[model samples]
Each structure stands twice: as structure tokens, then as C-alpha cells.
Target: MPEKYHISTTPVPPRLPRIGKYGIVDWREDCARCHNCVKKACVYDRHRQESAYLRTLKYSNFLFFECMGCFYCVQNCTKELLALTINSEYENLGNQYWTPEIIQTTWQQAETASVPVSGAGYRGKFAGRGFDAMWTDMSEIVRPTRDGIHGREYISTSVDIGRKPAHLEFKEGRIVSETPEILDIPIPLILDMNPPEFTLPRLEPFILEAVRMTDIIAIVDSTKWPECLNEKQRQRMDAYLPNIAFHLNSEAPEIPKDVLRKTRMVEIPDSDDALDRRAALREAVPGIVVSIRVPLNKRGVDRAVALVDQGADVIHGVADFNGNEINVKNPRFIKDMIREIHTRLINSGARDQVTLIAGGGIALPEHMAKALLCGADVVSSYLPFMIALECRLCSDCKPGLSCPAGLEAIGFDYGVGRMRNLIAAWYLQLIELMGAMGMREARRLRGDVGRAMFFEQMEEEIFGTLFGTRKQA
Candidate 1:
């Protein structure tokens, strides 16, 4: 067996003071100075840490709220002087979709590169919108030998990124068949380009460095090539070329033929003549994989089938930033769209011919696994990479306005380390999830509906007979 894949990580502290969920409110006027106070009994020693943090505080308006919310101090206080209060700043950290909890959890993973554990246990709803509406089966979790992260067994998370032949033909003990080139990435995740609002020229180097370290590919706009890279980076371009995928617009000038020849993969937007464009690029740059980016809207499923039938090496189904279908009031979620596309491809007998990569709402490690279960061969994300560097997602990034998170002034080492740590943490989680599900290969997990349950199906099966059809809100 090949050596196990492991991600080495070290602690990378956050740049700003943490906006923890709870804070301690002490009524000093009513406090009785006991010899042995409840403050000393804090298991986390939050009181002493708060005092130390306050003594050397740099920002005057920033409050200290690192309390663990154990409620031990509040419950055991003699004069009822201590109380736990929710921090308003924590509530305002992220918007509704990108919840504050998600941002904080991402920060913790990037800093520590460890699986997050909510000690208090899950307190949220059983089912909600998007990926939350699905659940994975953990029936095999009790098996001791299936633990992949602990080295008991090997679980492969590697995936290919090109066309795959359905079968082989041979005659006279010799095979004469053509096979397209394929690129194998260690993890089934890709680094996508950040949205226009979050784009930064200085950050590309760090992003490339992170991709190189993780042994994964990143999609970069081909127009920004050569010029955006430093002299040293330009010199080392060949070494990193395999880890980079270029994004080319159909109407834009073609990328230099030399660069395209050296690259392993290139992505083009889905257009009227997408198949023709793919054929042209294949003829121009042999051995280069071409992926068509299909918008995950009303026509996404049909488009994906058409591309696969027309010999596309890869079909990348993308949704809006929030994972919803664009310009549709009653839009289906990206997960549903991926499922529909996957099923259609299977029905059309083209499921094994090409790869399917899904993006645009994959915000967490679990979402990566869930996307594969919904039929994506691989998943891509960009927001978590920025969030690793403490981006608040203010949605106000523009000229003449100072970045609230100081992203522009971030150093290369810090940014790369944080992004690498986040990837390591996510990789560990993926292995752990695969082990628990009793699957040893990521390819086997693709479109394996038996290993997962959809909330809508369960709701309809159980309540439809009792209560008739569900009413629209």
C-alpha cells in the first residue's frame, strides 16, 4: 500500500481579537471579595486571561469576550454578581448564509488545523435548507478497523480530472485504443477564483503557494498570467504549472499557446459553440484537459448532458455565491441541481465518460463530502480561503475604502500558512467522514444515494399520507 496522506500543521494565531460567542458581565459593586472566589474556579482561567489581555490591549473600543460560556463562574458566584451575556459583535460577524458560527469555526480550523468539536453538542435544527437538508449514514462508525485518520485502514480521497473510458477493446493480444490525458489530484477539492469583490493581485502568489503545498490545482484567470507573478515565481512557473488551471473567457483573447501547452487543464465558460471550442483547444494543445463551466440554473442539467455527450472532458456546474440558481425566485439548490444532472447523465449512459466538478456554495468540509454524495466528482471553493486570512466578508471591498480586515496588508507567510492549515483540517475531516461511512475510495462515494438520506424524501414519505401535500410558504 502507498504511504498514508498526512498534513503537517502548526498553530497560526488569528490577527485580530476573537469575537467569542459569550462574555462575562461582572457587577463589581455587588461583589463580595471572598478569599477563594468563583473567578479562580474558572476551568479556562478566563478571568486572569481577560485581565492580562486588558492590561496590554491595543484597541480601545475592542472588548474582551473570550469567555468559554461554561457558566461555572456565573452559577457558583456567591452574590450573583457574574452573568454570561451574548456578544453582539459575534452576532454581526457574518451574514445569514455565512453564519457567524461558520466563520468562527473556519478560523479555529485554520489556526489549529484540527477537527472542530462543539463540546455542548448539536443544538440546531435537524434539517434546514441547502446541504443541511441531507444526512449521511454512519452505521459503520462503530467498526474499529475502519478508522482511516488513525491509520487503521487507508481511505483514498484522490480523484481524476479528465475523461474516462467506459470499457476497453483488444484484438490479437494487442490493444489499439486512444485515451485522453487525465490529472490526478491528491484531494477531491480545487481552489476556485475568488469573486470579483474579493480579488487581490498580491494574494495570487499566496494562493498558488497554498495550492502547491496541498498538491491541488487552482483556477486562475489566464489574462493575469506572467504579469501578476514576480520574477522568482515566473522562473518557477513550470514547477507550479501542473498545480494551476487557467480560466479563459470565450470572447477574450486566447491564452498564449506556449502557456496552454505547459498547463495540465484549462476551463472555459459554457457557450453556444462550447464543443467546438473544446475541439479547437484539444487540437491546439494536445494532452491538455478542458473543463466547461456550466451555470447551475434552469437549463443546467440539459447542458451538462449535452456537454458529456459531445465529449467534454469535464463539466463544472456552478451556482451563485449563495448556492442558488441565478435569476430564479423558486430556484433549486445547487445540491439538487447536481443530483439532477448526475441522474440525467446516468440515464443517458454518460456518467462514466466525464468528470463533474461542483462549486459556488461549498463553505465547509462537510459540504465537500455532501457535494460528492450528490454526484459531484470533485468540489471547489474560494470563500473559505479568504476567511482563513480573517476576511470578514464585508461585501464592501472597493477603491477609496480601507479594508476592514486589512487583507491588503497581509504578509505572504501568514496568508499561505492559514490557507494551508484550513486545507489540512478539511482533508482530515474528509478522511474521517469517509472512514465512518465505510467507503475506502472517494470515487465510490460519488452519487451513492444509499449512503445518504434526503430530508424532503423522508418528509414526503412519512407525512404526505397523513397530511396530504406540503403547502408553500
Candidate 2:
């Protein structure tokens, strides 16, 4: 058996004060001044740490809100002087979709390469919008031995990206069919290009290094080409070509034949001449896997099916950065879009012939698993990596504007380490999720809705007949 995949991670502390969810407001005037005060009983030592933080505080108004909100101190206080208050800073961290909780959790994962555990149990609603509307079945969690991450059983998270042959053809004594080349990555996650606002000259190197460390592929725009890399980087690019995928558009300059030959995969935007481009790329690099990138709009599903029928090797359905369908007011979520595409391809009897990659709004490790369950063979994410590097997701990221969080000043080592830690954390979480679902292979998890429950489906089954269709607001 091949060696098991592992990610080496070390704790990378945050650059700024942590924006945690809850803060303790101590009413010292009502304190009894007891030597054995409830504040002293803090298991996490948050009170002592808060005092230390205040002594050397860089910003006087910046309050320490790292309290875990366990309520042990609040309930134990003799005079009811201690109370937990929601941190305003935390509530304002991210937009509605990328909530403050999500940002903080991603930060913790990036720093420690471990699952985020609130000392207090889940304090959120049972179901909400987006990915929360779907839940993976964890009935198998009762079996402790099924733990893939730390148990004796090995749950494979590896997936192949390329055209798969439906069946083998043979002559009397030998095989007579040609086999397409496939790229296999240990984890079903790929690093996507950063959005225009966050794009920086130094960012590419950091992304390439992280991709190299994780042994996975990154999607790079071909138009940028060799200009994006320095001479040294260009020379070393050949070695990492297998881990790189070039994204090509009609206007992009032609890639050198030698460079194309070294790369295992290339993605072309969906167009009328996409098949012609795919053919040209294959003619240049005979074994190259060509993936068609289609926007997850109304036509996405039909377009994906057409490309598959035309002998496309892979189909990538991409949504907006926030995971919503583009150009529509009532946009469908990426999950629903993926499910539609997967089902359509299956109905067309071409699902197994091509690889499906879903991108955009893949913020968490759980999101990766959920995307797969929705029918994507793998997922791509770029924003999480930025978050890993302490990016505050400021609205204005122009060159002239001063960066609120000083992201441009980040050292390469620190940035790369944090990104690597985030990937490691995500990989561990994926393994844990697969184990709980009783799935031994990540590939099998694709389109396996039987192992998951959709809120809309349940609502229709239980409440539809009596109440009719639920009205959308």
C-alpha cells in the first residue's frame, strides 16, 4: 500500500487580538472580594490572561473577548456580578453568509490545524440557510472503531480528476483501447485563484508553495503566464507542473507547447469553441485532462451535459464568490445547482465518464464534504486561504487603500505556514466526516444523498400535503 498522506502543522498565533464571540463583563463594585472567587476557577485561565493582555494593551478600548462563555463563573458568582455579553466586534467580522462565527472558526483551524470545539455545545438554530439546510447522517458515530483519522481502519479520501473509461476493451490476447490520463490527489480539495481585489504579486508564490506542500493542484490563469513568476520560479515550475492547472480563456495567450506537455490538466471556460480548444490542447499534450469551467447559472446543467457528450474529460461548475448563481435575482445555491447538474448527468448516462469539480463559497472543511455529498467529485476554495493569512476581508482592497489588517506585510513563511495548517485541519475534518458517514472512499461520497438529509425534501414529505407548497418570501 502507498504511504498514508499526512500534513505537518504547528500552531501559528494570530497577528491581532482575537475577535471571539463572547466577553465577560465583571461588575467589580458588587464583588465580595472573596479570595476563592469564581473568576479564579476559570478552567481556561481566561481571567488571568485577560489581565495580562490589558497590562500590555496596544489599544486601550480593545477589550479581551476570548472568554468561552461556559457560564460557570456567571452562575457561581455570589452577588450575580458576572455576565457574558456578545462581542460587537465579533458580530461585525464578516458579511451575512460568512458570519463572524465562520471567520473565527476558520482562524482557529488555520492556527491549530484542528477542529474548532466550543467548550459550550452548539448554540445555534437546528437549520438555517445555505449548507445548513442539509445535514449528513451520523448514525454510524456509535461505532468508535470506525474513526478514520485515529482508528485502525483506513478511510480513503483520495479522488481522481480526469475522464474515466466506462469499461475495458480487449482483443484475444491484449487490450485494444486507449486509456485517458488521470490525476490523483490525496485530498479532494484544490486551491483556486484569489479574487481580483485580493490579488497581489507576492500572493502567487505563497499559493504555489502551499499547493506544493499539500501535494494538490492550483488553478492559475493562463493569461498571466510566465510574467506571474520570476526567473527562478519559472525554472522550478516544471517540477510542480503536475500540481498546477492553467485556466484558459479565449483572449489568453497561447501557452508554450513544452509547458502544456508538463501540465497534467488545464481548464477552459465554456464556449462555443470549447471542444475545439479541448481537442487542440489534447493534440499538443496527448495525456492532458481538459476541464470545462461553466458558471452555475440557469444554463449550467444543460451546458455541462452537452460538454460531457462532446467528449469532455472534466466539467467544473462555478458559482459566485458567495456561492450563489450568477446573473439572477432569485439565485440558486451552489449545493442545489450541483445536485441538479449531477442528477442531469446521471440521467443522461454520462455521469461516470467525466469528473465534476465545484468551486466558490467553499469556506469550511464541512463545506467540502457537503459539496461532495451534493455530487461534486471535489471542491475548490480561495478565500479560506486568504482568511488563513489573517485577511480581514475588507470591502476595499485596492492598491492605494491602506490595508486594515496589514495583509501585504505578511511574511512568506508565516503566510505559507498558516495556509498549510488550514489545509491540514480541513483534511482531518474530512476524514472525521467520512468516518461518521460510514464511507470508506471519498469518490463514493459523491451524489450520495442517501447518506444525507435535505431540509426542503423533509419539509415537502411531512408538511406539503396538509399546507400545500411553502411560500417563498
Candidate 3:
């Protein structure tokens, strides 16, 4: 059997703010007192004699016991007995992304953070998007020595976020002329500004604050820098405005010299006017990098490369806003898009001179590394923030704009704190995931694409050759 996991639990106490929720196993009080019920099935045969449910009540160290909570007993009962409910008597297991059960054991130590115990237990879904869907080749799980972070094995997760020179010089040779600076970001994430309807103008302000706190960049929509910003916000904005990277329309006939002065980056949706706009914007702004954001379709990738040759330094491609691939015919999907671009860059002479950023479809923590492995330098997430703000992935943010948090209308102090906490939690989760993946630093995770296994590709490569592409046989 696989080794068990356990966490310590104290008797339910008062004054704690109820960090999380624990599930309660509620059985109908009307359970017929006389039935030699068929529901008393236990793998070890303990429940076969009946009345075994009595022992489960005062579970002091429940971690050591086997409740598996399979609900099999509930369904098999002749009396149609049993139900599960929230256990307010105990702390909750986890938060939105980290389910309650996962939080039961500290991800960092691989042991119970609260206390250590062991048992036969399983928690959470087998799969979900991003890293959860990934299995991370832990074939060596039983091998005591190869236990990634805990067993002293090396797993790398660090990544570089900005552009780099395509070529480098040798130390044996005298210094050849060094190439220009292609900026770098320590983390693989950049907060993209989607902007709230009423809180639109303050979007840049919040982004600036985020960059300040996290030491990462924020992608701002240049159009939202309206005049509604307060005096303090505007003054602070001037100091930060210089560092902020602005996303603007590359073909917008005329970009003001003043506005250009504040922006260090420009982005345009894929268009035929790429080269002309890149030149015009560069001539107007001089030191900023021009970027092209494309959907991860075949056509989009083609347009992105064409734009790159025309002097775009940043190539940003993305899948659907909901993390789905664009083309149904060649639906290798988002990561595939990154691989194609990475290979394209290696083939073209521009690989080093340009940076690649892929967004959309990054739902969970491990995806940051996955994208880099697929060859993107940086990735951004939009929906997760909405989730943090209590959006249940409802996607109505663009519709009636019925956010109760006034996320659509804010200058509120609590709003900012709440956002900070959410980001902090996400950052922590990212670090923990990277740690579990045996990746110590984010920079090392770039292009380390071999960490994941693609189900479709694996099946095609392994089964197709044998089946010889059977034609509906």
C-alpha cells in the first residue's frame, strides 16, 4: 500500500477565527435500530458484524483511522442512511484553489503541518487544468532517495521573464561588442490589467502597487489612464509610470510623445500593419519594446513570426481566454503553441533578440513552468484574480458587471488589502508547487518542458504506429 499522510488536530477550541471548514459525517438519526444492514461493508471486514459505526464518534486522532469517507456505507444501507456535512468543530482543510483536504497536510513539509500521523487516505480530484492535470513523472515515488524536495533530488523551477540576446560571447576571447539590454523578470508571471468598469482609471494604480509589492511587472492597458485618478494616486503614478509597461494599439495613427515617454512596452493584436506600426512607434518612443499579442492559432503563430521579422522584440501568443485551444483541426493547444514558437525562434535568427510571453489558459501554478518549457519566457493570468475576488468562474464580469465587492467600483482600502492577500496566497501556492515539482527557483524552469506528459501525443505516438491509423475499422 502507498504510504499514508496525516496532520495533527487539537480539540475544537474557541477564539480561533475558523480558518477553514472540515466536513461532518452526518448519519440519519432514524437509522433503523434492528437491521443487520447490508451497508456494513468494510474491506478489512470490521463493519460486517454491524455497530462498528459507534467507534467513529470520538475520533481523537482521526488521521490514523480509516474513514475513507467513501460513502459506500451510506449508499448500501437498507435503511437508506448516512450523509456528509461540514464539520465546524474542526478547521477547514484549504482555500479556493487548495482544497480543504490538501491543506490538511502541509505541502511544504510533505507531512502534517498541524501534526504528523499516518493512514490510508486520499484527497481531491485526480485532475484539473494546469499542473493538477499533470502527473509529474513521480514513477520514482517509492524510491526513498529520489523524493524531490524532501529526498535531496534536484527539481528546478526558476525562469527568466524578459528578452535576451539570441547569441552570446566566449570568455576565452576578448570582449566583443555586447548586445543591448533585454530586460529580465525574476518571476514568470505578469499581472495583466483587465480593469473593472467603475474602477477603470485606478487599474494602473493597483497594477503599479502590485509590481511594487511583488517585484514583478504588470501589463497595463494604456487606454485606461483617464483623468479620474486622485492627486496622491496621480503623483505616485508619475514615479511609477516610468516603470510601467503600457499595452497600446500599434496602428493607432498617432501616439502622443508624452504618452510614449511613460511607456516602455507596446502591444498590438495581430495585424498586417505590424512592421509599419513597429517602426512608427519606435521612431516616436525610441527606447520601448514593441510587442505583438496573437491568439494561439496557426494563423496567429504565422502572423507573430512575420511581425517579429519586422522588428517586434516581444512575441506574445495566447490560447482562448478560457484556456482552450483555438483551432479544432490541429488542437495541440496552448503549450503546443509555445513549442511551435520556441522551435520557430530557434529556426529564425531572432530567437535571442525577442522575448516570448504566453497568456490565456494558465489556470494553475504548474502552468508557469509548463509554458516556459514550451518556450515562453513569461505567462500571465486573468481569471485567477477574478476567482480570488470570489468570482466562481461565472464569466459575467464582462456582462452586467454585478460584482458585489465593488470590485467594479473601488478606491476602498479593504479592496486593496484583499487583493494583496490573494496575491500573497497565490504566490505562496506557486512557490509550494514549484518546490513539489523539485524546482527550487523560477528561472531554472524555463524551457524545461520535459516535465509534463501530453496524453494525446503519448497515445498517438505509441498507439498510432501499431494501429497504422485504422480507418474506422
Q: Which candidate is the best by lDDT?
A: 1
Cα lDDT listed for each candidate: 0.86, 0.85, 0.54
**What tens digits encode model 2's per-residue C-alpha lDDT throughout 1-473?**
55788988889888878878889999998789988999999998999999999989997667899998889999999999999999987787767787787888889988998988866577888898889999999888757537566756688899999988898899998878878889998999988877675653346667777888899988988877866554666788876777789998578888888888888889998999999988988887898888889988878777887888878879988888888887788988999999988998898888997899999789889999999999999999998888887676766667867865678788777887888899999999998898888888999999999989999989999999989988875
Encode model 1's per-residue lDDT on 79-151: one tens digit a residue.
Answer: 9999999999888876777888889999999999999988878877899989999999978887763767688
For candidate 3, the 10 contiguous residues with the lowest summed lDDT are 106-115
Measured over all alpha carbons after superposition, the RMSD of each candidate to the real structure, in angstroms, is: 1.6, 2.0, 10.1
TM-score of each: 0.96, 0.94, 0.65
Ranking by TM-score: 1, 2, 3
Clashing pairs for model 2 are none
Cα displacement (Å) at residue 395, model 3 = 4.2
User: Could you tell which candidate, 1 or 2, scores higher by TM-score?
Assistant: 1
Off by over 4 Å in 1: 200-202, 250-253
Report residue 229 deviation for candidate 2 (angstroms): 4.5
